[model samples]
Target: MADIQDFKSTPKYETFSYLPPMTPEKIRRQIAYLVSQGWNPGIEHVEPARASAYYWYMWKLPMFGEQSVDVIIAELEACHRAHPGNHVRLIGYDNYSQSQGTSFVVFRGK
Candidate 1:
């Protein structure tokens, strides 16, 4: 007889999905890296159930030419406030490459 599988599978999202939840300090560091790389930052949110969907709702226009990590964090907080039950993610868009350079979940919905 074949052996039976006993483990369950979990869905993995964007960057850092395999790691534990990030702290505020860690998040700030990530934002700083984004700024240092000159990549535009954007926020998007979606319900936990629909997190695997192809699209998410944009919080606002990407912060172009903004170098302040504080500003980015504030915007992320605001998006969380507006969508407390949604999974929120921060994405870094590379203008030169015209593609997304980094993406990670900043907040997980209940």
Candidate 2:
């Protein structure tokens, strides 16, 4: 017989959910890739409890045509500072495909 009490259901978010939390270096690498691909970068955040919700609050307008990885990192850090208790994610918008190309959590909140 199986014990229901022993079963744990962990919620998985977007990309990289199965892996460990990303470090600052990993995040920078990802942002660099996005920039290299000519994809627009955007920041979104939500409370951990509401991570499963359909939509997260966008930090600001997407950085369309932005090419500086440093600027993106700065914005990400700013978002983290404002919402230290929220889960922060970085998303890449592919202009060629007219859709989102990738998304992953950069910061996991309590």
| Model 2 residue 25 distance off true place after TM-score fit, in angstroms | 1.7
Q: What lDDT is obtained when candidate 1 is compared to the true structure?
A: 0.88
Give the candidate number with the greatest lDDT: 1
Each candidate structure's TM-score, on Cα atoms with residue i matched to residue i, is 0.89, 0.87
Q: In candidate 1, which residue pairs get closer than 3 Å at backbone N, Cα or C atoms, i.e. clash? A: none
> For candidate 2, which ten residues in a row score worst on lDDT?
1-10
**lDDT by residue (tens digit), candidate 1, 1-110:** 13332235356787587666678999999999999999999999999899896699999899898899999999999999999999899999999999998999998898
Q: Candidate 2: which stretches are off by over 4 Å?
A: 1-9
Where model 1 places Cα greater than 4 Å from the true spot, the runs are 1-10
Error of 2 at 65 (Å): 1.1
* Alpha-carbon local distance difference test for all models: 0.88, 0.87
